[model samples]
Target: MASKANKELESWIKHLSGEDMPVFSGTVADVTESVNSEDSSASEVAQTILRDASLTSRLLKVANSFNYNPGGKKISTVSRAVMVLGFEQVGALTLTLALVDSLSEGVQRHKLTEEMAQSFHAAIQAQQLAKKMGCKSPEDIFVATLLSRLGNMAFWAFSGQKGTEVLNLIQSENLTEQEAELQVLGFRLRDLTVGLSKSWSLGELLDDFLSDHHGNDERHNIISIGQELAEAAKNGWDSEQVAIIFEQAAKKLGLSVDEVEELAHQNAKHAKEITRIYGVTDASKRIPQPNIDMGLIEEDVDEAKSDSTDEPRLTITEDTSTAVTSKYPEPDSNVQLTIMQEITSAIEEKPSINIILEMVLEGLHRGVGMDRALFAILSPDRRTLTCKYAIGEDNERLCKELRINLSNTNNIFHQVIDSKKAMHVPSDPKKLTGTLSRDTLTLLGPPAYLVMPVIVRSKVIGIFMADRNASGRDIEEKDFIAFQQFCQQANMGLTFLAM
Candidate 1:
């Protein structure tokens, strides 16, 4: 009964669905089911999310961000956030974060992070527009729009260069994204989303919203208009393209052209705040301001860069594991020095000792762009190097397996602790020595990795280990220097805690 395109899409869907798809939190699944049951409570949903410290921090950050707070009192606790934004909104946010966290691993994180920021921005804009149009429960609309974009996200994440070809074709030939996707990938991307939504048990509303039910379906038009404005603004706010998109959106939302343009500007500003909430700082910095000229936007971004710990280089994510290269020339020493200063300043805040270590791990994982990072503290008696914090896929497994026995004090980790030197071991047995436990080696997935000891008062207190793992980026000397410096700053924080 299916058309060739439909059949082909189903085949692709089957392939993707049958593959080990990323699972969101078990709590997300359970909480959603419990919400409809007889005995659901807001406290129950809040507790589930709080179980994961990272997710809890993320949710608190979003709840406290300017987008939601808007000069209101800051919401400090998860219970307060849950009370303010109803269970549905909190559940939706939890699902979104879980989805992002699950899918971001073992892929090009930088590229996924950009796409995720845009997707979140688009969903927010669409939801606001839908709410203005008298759609009840725009949160459902928000999650639906986001879920319907999974096919595009998956293509960009796992399809690699082939996906880029589809993207380039859309730009070069002026083809619709779906048209280019069909030509390049043998199926329309939306159809893949359709299949995935059904398979993933997302509500049928996603299908209806993504459909071509134009006249009676204001939701579809609102989402389309949001995407259009977002795409147009990416070109330049002052472009003729922006005027056209705004005109279309104005008609759909029953607003004047000026009103629609004002809405776009507001969304742009709010989107910037929301982007920061999710820790996508680079993407937040690059958000286009609808009223500002392109030149002024650059100046604003540069000014922001002055206050942050970033090196000003445009990064292009490629299919290759080592593909994220800066477009500009190599940065000078001042760049690293600036980031170290930022880290040191943050450490001076003297957050809880656990929070301090997590911040350092994030600095390595997100700032330094490592695929996997682990912070392993020495046991009280200094008998074992036990992974205490990890960021990446299979992190739980890594933590369990990366328990390095210090009984063999001649092992590589022990040697690094003794010498207080960082080591980057490339794919050489001579380089490996007794450094890697079999469990650690198995997790590394490649022949090489890097480890540096976290020393305090001239005594090794922990180990900082990171690698590209199956992503396959070879360790570079520059990256090692950055990691070593990160560990050094971490030591200062640890010492402060010790004192």
Candidate 2:
């Protein structure tokens, strides 16, 4: 039996990682690796997300949603989203959105929808319970709970003959879910979830909860209650089973039974809206509506619509359909303006220099349509420059390779800093032959690029560099103007901090 189970698990894993959902598998792997690495910065994570324009837009929307951004602050860029929502929160949201995008369109979509709805419902329930218990990170609990049933969701999404057989066994024999999975697939779906969690490095909390479903830890107990409530609520919020789960949660959370009941009801409604925000509208519709007052639900819906309208919409010069299908990003004036405003707000609020740099880099990459953008800070000794934050293609490699020796006054980068002026390198290779060194050319490629000094209080503190090499597009006059403007904003922000 053990051998059979191992083989079955491996087979299912192979199937899921194969052609069925390659994009999702790749996303999970990329995001997990980036988020889990000790050296990974928020900029790195943002770059990972920004590679997919659709994912980027969806993540920003979720970050700006009421549940995530209660303060009503608009998140225009993925960099700001990472800063505002937190690194783990943004990573979790990316994984969630990727999962929905990958699995929402496959075969047995109805079953997938049920799994997605259940996960969302349980996630919200767990998050609410975590908040009530005063846990340090409710978002962690939410993500852990949502992905707890990964095997079940993935199975329904990509499984073929074996899946139908398992379903048939459950229906015909009246067996429980695990028994059906075990009889047909040689292992339980829960075991598969544990396997996938490990392989994907989803998180320690998820692995721990899957390993000990009935653990004594308070956080784990909350997760268990959340999943149970989601399952029981399928029968109805007022069902006896739900009542029992609520009673247990009330005791665990040190809350009255009435309070637990109310929280559960509110979370159910919240889960519905959150699922919709995630672009899984089908799953959102499948989520059971709590037996709450109709008037209150209507009021909530109206408020959500109003809040959405207030969000700054992206405005592209090209037609909407063409822009969506275009391979390269077009300059978005709306996003550029919004990010500029955010930078001003960050300066007023006394944010970290890293935050200011990140926003500027985002402005150059996404707003100004640069194929690659980076911020390189001068070493304290003032002898060398090193990349601190970067975005766009091959950013990780760019970060490591982007170094300039300040003593080389002949270099264009050094000249920019010395003069405290912005320079736009034309695409003509002849113009860069002497001024641009061979090492710089190898690192940045031979393309039109922009370099500007970030001056604070009349001192050149750093430099901003951007290029259109990835897209092989020539640096336009407007791009240079926008790049200079963003660098100026960064200088102003740093000056404010110095004050």
Candidate 3:
């Protein structure tokens, strides 16, 4: 019943179904050679690769469909591709396409079933979704989508007749392929895809999408939109219905549906064409142009399908406060996650360690309603904590040269250093000596204050001191504990940096 061309195509592709197909060398070599090129001509060389008619065409189709190439005249030259994508980037892109081609070779293709056409359609739709969403790197969307369904391909290749049965049920049943997969293979296609992605060492983002795409993660959502478009192709869904589904999906994935519709449509068309150029087909039945609403319902249905396999939830016995307790008893998971986030955020915003101290000083000054805040770190010699950053008093810099002896009997710094832990000083500055003991407070200066040592790697590294307004009141127990927690977090951050 099938055409001879289709039968031959299936046989050749089935040869690829072997689990032991040698890693496609041409693709890897192309990427390696590109990377190894002399720096001076890297750009030119990369341009040449993009300029190849076949490669250029593929790239354009991918870019346009992925929704990444800013709309203009269709890109026809490698020079333009190089300029738009850059040299290093062009290498990355070439590598991606090369990988896709190599992997798809041995994949089984039932020629008459139009499987290859559907694959191209899905890939192009994914790229368009990326562009429409204004994704910074829509090329990635193309790559992710192109590779997303490889798991299903490999399943068919290896399982042979059994795989065909699964595919048959998927096309016949209105249920998801994942459900049919469970019936036929006892595991999900996603599990296979993730395994292959890991084995191939694909980029982290792609790996994330492959593993997490069906879930609430955005990349997953984008790929889902691609699949939805592919489904639309089969169902003969009208543009309006497609737009509604697209808009709903875009909102869920934080994309603008109205703005991306043209892009999505273009991408879907391109992916369909590209996959057709190859030899893949969709196993799902095409829905004819169906009318659909665009809104919360779409999101709910999609998300529900994604999370359906999750295990049942059990009651949590721990209270919220106690749940924050450290998983790592010594290092403290709660403290680490908190401090790491703060330090990473601060560094991400402003790339300086001094900025961290400034942040601490500002928080203490305002958050505690303090008149002044001082942050001092011990010199490498361990003699004193030099005032690195401060807020409040104008003479804070004048006190920059200040140091408290680590071994001095009257020094509170010595007590904290000796203990190798936090020591809180409340309302009793007179008990301390030297600069710390300075009772300018007795002269009606800033009244209540607290000082805690910054310990890192079992050694006292710095000291943080905060002075309250001239109210002469004692610090509250809760406030002291909060301050202690803050110091602990700071200590953990500093320790991590030291490592």
Candidate 4:
């Protein structure tokens, strides 16, 4: 029976391979172009936004959220919304809007449980910790807490009916959701999110925040605080263990125990606010979407039609609407030699990844107007992809929440991991239609994306991603060559870091 189940799983995976992969939108590309343009004025930014009605509306809605104003007077214009939020918040809101818009509308179910309420409570607890630690923006704490366990949402989105089975295994069998997902699906949602975030150009700050599982730094420590609180509050971890993690974290972050307690109280207060916004109920049986029921599944297969320009027939799969299975250009010896010379010379110098990633990402932003670029290192176990460095602007908190479990099926990161190769998708809206499922698309944000695996010897060591503007432009040969060179240098740098 076990062997039969394995065969069926393999067959399903193979069938999925033949189907088209999902594609992300060029939202991040837009953010990139707007920020990097010659003028880069508020007017240019507003003009750029005028083109996308979705971003306009999302900006307004988030502006209306309690963070913006204590009172609610609906301001009706994008410019007005921008005025209210300032440029930084406006940019963040735009990314957030694009992300929410791209989520899948597929049939899946999420059961809101007492534990769900408890999770919110934990998020608030984390916020309190941030405040106690003197984080100026407690709201950053709120956002961090809100999204730390978003992998839970990803699981519910992908698992369909067996979400419960997967959740049960996590709880009863003492497994992380990513581990269980590997047993069931070959990849976990975390894997999908990291690749998707890079592809969509969600920005480096968010990329780093989302994938920073290590809670060592000040920024990452907040997310670690939140995760610990959430696990304690929802999972019923022993109070002593929770206190230990908290005390140790607080000491590292330079906060007192009294301060941590006050933060926990704030968490309790904010839990109500989260509940009100999402309309989650303690006893709710289903997450907002329906469970996957193939019995009720509708196939919307378009007749195999050739592209107008005679490229490959890009099938729009339930996962994505874009065709992005192209190979990356090989490294250019000229560029590689220069970059490698710089890297080798700098090894003893110990350059920051920020400086290095910026040189690479900034070049892409200049060459093709990519918004941002990021890189991740696969864990020694190869089960997790943790963001190591990023370039571009956004909140550091979001990066802290980012992590990719290698088992997630919904993301292109896993594809890069498995194939140990490069993945690129063009930004033509026509081509992007079914290349990415809505949710993965939304989470990642920018549509036009490329993922390149960094291999040393035969072993896969890391992955690099670059994203273009909302235009979702295809990576030209020159750009691909530069990317390969960048990867080669980056791999060497990381190797040095390890040594």
Candidate 5:
């Protein structure tokens, strides 16, 4: 009986899939899927989002919103918008708008309105509070806090259960909101939200907010305070619940209660301004101002969850200076994936050194779509790496003669072998003078290339090198990931062949 009950609860979570939601249009879905992919690019995702004219306008409006665009520079295109707002943020915002549109419909209209209003109001509060705290990724916190309640709000909007009954059960039975949810709907709203958040690949930060709730952490406190304050605002500012929440928040923020009050009002003002952008259509039904109805007591915010305030920023580095200096264009992703598949299949059926080496070179050339690729075997004594297989040059004869000594050198190729990590070398020798030697540059056919070491159980065995050569095509993060995965797979095949 217990097992059957558990499955029933899990079913509710399964129903909360992003696919079933009305907001997940194919374009929005594509951006989510693409940005989450290891081989996809911001520019590539931007291209897909651009296909939807309405979505493009929405993205630009938010990107050029007073917050993201401070320089007054006009973001004229979707591609530029994606760059400005960040691909992940753009994707999250797309989902946020769509989700509100879906959940704001149907029977639980009043209840749904309350939840959405609280979520948006709290999100803006968390964002402003986070900024004041010197948090690096305030935007991340804003999105996470807003989405934290997505599961509960979604459930309330969908479950057809009376909100009053759920609330009464929690109070009368002394059951937690999640406990009441399990008894009523067979699953926690958090279960639905966390599951869908991961499926949509919202960001790891949201995952942390949902999963990590260690007490005394500023991030969790910020989320908690945001929720509490939303309820306080709903009840009117001078209510007992609001006073308690403010007292607690004041302690965490190390501010006077008066100061906290000021910030809360300011946050309310901003929230009112951002309702349209955040998909809250009716601004008139805003958070009940503390000033307007002082001491009017209301119930606590229901089934709301916490999110993190700390920022984890990941930088996607592109060589801004080298685009003009490099001569070759980046490899196409489809071609790269196809080539990698072919290499994997060829090596699996025929694990011979020659066959594997040939396929690898072919991948680097035709698969990676690079101009040249070479396979060099490491000597038994680790004395040298000598080019034994080559492709993509007018003379494969000279390509075969290229060699590099194992002696200590500042060049990237040497670093790849020493560090056992693939290294990216773009055009512009002067920029990389700390590593690449003039002689090494002379040997490489292209100004840009990647050198990855092939290893077998930690022992360096051989080298895979390729470049656009004189064309100087700079590698991107996605391209680098593809190249690295190829190297790892090739290493396995080479290891088997060597045995």
Candidate 6:
């Protein structure tokens, strides 16, 4: 019987790996490999995502949503998104979106919708529990819990006759879920989940939970509780099953029963919101809210839809819609102000120089509406300037290519370093005594760029450069002023560090 089950699982794996779910499988593999790599950087992950325009837009929208960015800091670029949301969180989001997009295509079924809804609810519940327990990586728990039932979701989503048979057996014969799956498909869906998780190299957390579902591991326990809660809540929060699960969770978490219940209820609502954000509107509607009446829930959803259409709650300014749809970013003064405030807060903490530079780059790229922004630091001997941080189009390549030799004072960058004055090339190219170096023009493309020197202790130490070369947008006077303001903030940060 075990051998037969194994054979059946292998067949299902082969079938799923074929053309039916190529995008989902490929995305899981690629994202997992990118994040798991030892040498992985945010740029690499950003590059992987920037390849798909649709994915990039969807990801940015979700990242900026109130649920993720409660502080209202606008995330304008994929690189910034990766920085704001940790690498693991971004990977989880990408995988979740891919899964939803894949399953949501073609025919829709009630069973598939329920399974997806449960997955979303379970993930959010597990993530909230992990946070309450002070787990270091709540995103891992969320992803693991979401994928715990991958086999069931995938099978029901794509299966035709076999899926109906399994459901009929469970309903008619009053058989257990596992018994029905085994009788109809010759293997349990749990076994299929294990196989898929292994084949895709999902993660160690998933592998650990699947291999030992009843282990002493705290994370595994949280995931188990989340799944149980999601299933029991279907009978409504006032049901005896929900009460039992709450008692169990209260004991496990060392929280009062009321606190556990409150946490679960809040997480359920968040699950619905996040599910809709992932573009699974139908599944989101099915996630049961604890105390809210169905009519009220529907009314709330309609209001949310209306609000999203009239004025997106995610962005800070009215021009955010332009920023989203246009090739060039529109200047958002509100985002700039928020980011500047964050920079001031970061400065007070006295963090590393890299932290300050990253925030500054984000400001220039997102807040100032530059197509590309870069910070280059002078070598100890002051002979060369190397790109230290960058954000925007082709940023990884820009980092590699942006190098300036200061020995040649005839170049535009060196002139800024020498004079300690900001230069806007498009405003008046002839005002500068020196010309742009062949390397600079070749790498940065054309004129219409801003360059500012970073002066500390009355000496130039680095430079902040920005341009709209990618989108070929004109750098207006206002943009130049914003760029200078951000550069001054960088100068202030560096001076504080020097002190």
Q: What residue pairs clash in candidate 6, if any at all?
A: none
Task: Please provide TM-scores, in order, for all candidate models, with all chains considered together.
Answer: 0.53, 0.89, 0.40, 0.43, 0.52, 0.71
Per residue, candidate 4 scores C-alpha lDDT tens digits across 37-90 of 664444335544534433443455556678565576544344344444555556
Better of 3 and 6 by lDDT: 6
Q: Give lDDT tens digits, candidate 6, residues 1-499.
A: 8888788889899888886677788888878887888976665676556545456668878888998889887776665677678788899888887777677643326667678889999999999999999998899899999999999888877777887798788889999989998898898898989999998788999999999856678999899999999999877778899999999999988899999999999999999988888777767887998876656646644655455335422221122443265655568897688778777876786866766777777778767888878889899999899987677777777788888777877877887888889988763566656777778678878788899998887888899899888887888899999999988998998899889
TM-score of 3: 0.40
- lDDT by residue for model 5 over 228-297, one digit each (tens)? 7886777676678888887888999988988888898889878866765553554224466646643332
| lDDT score for residue 342 of model 6 | 73
**lDDT at residue 404 of model 3 (Cα atoms):** 51
Residue 42 in model 1: lDDT: 46
Number of clashing residue pairs, candidate 4: 67
Q: Where is model 6 more than 4 Å wrong at Cα?
A: 1-112, 150-201, 238-282, 291-323, 348-350, 426-443, 446-448
Global lDDT of each model?
Answer: 0.66, 0.80, 0.51, 0.50, 0.64, 0.80
**Reference-based TM-score, model 6:** 0.71
For model 2, how does the per-residue alpha-carbon lDDT over 275-383 read when each residue is reduced to its tens digit?
8877777667666777654455345445543543353121111123313444456787777899899888777878778888988998888889888889898988877
lDDT of 1 at 91: 74
Relative to the unseen true structure, what is the Cα RMSD of model 5? 17.1
Candidate 1 regions exceeding 4 Å error are 1-20, 25-31, 34-39, 70-77, 106-114, 164-180, 292-499
Off by over 4 Å in 5: 22-41, 45-48, 67-73, 86-92, 161-180, 198-201, 294-499
Pick the winner on TM-score between candidates 2 and 6. Answer: 2
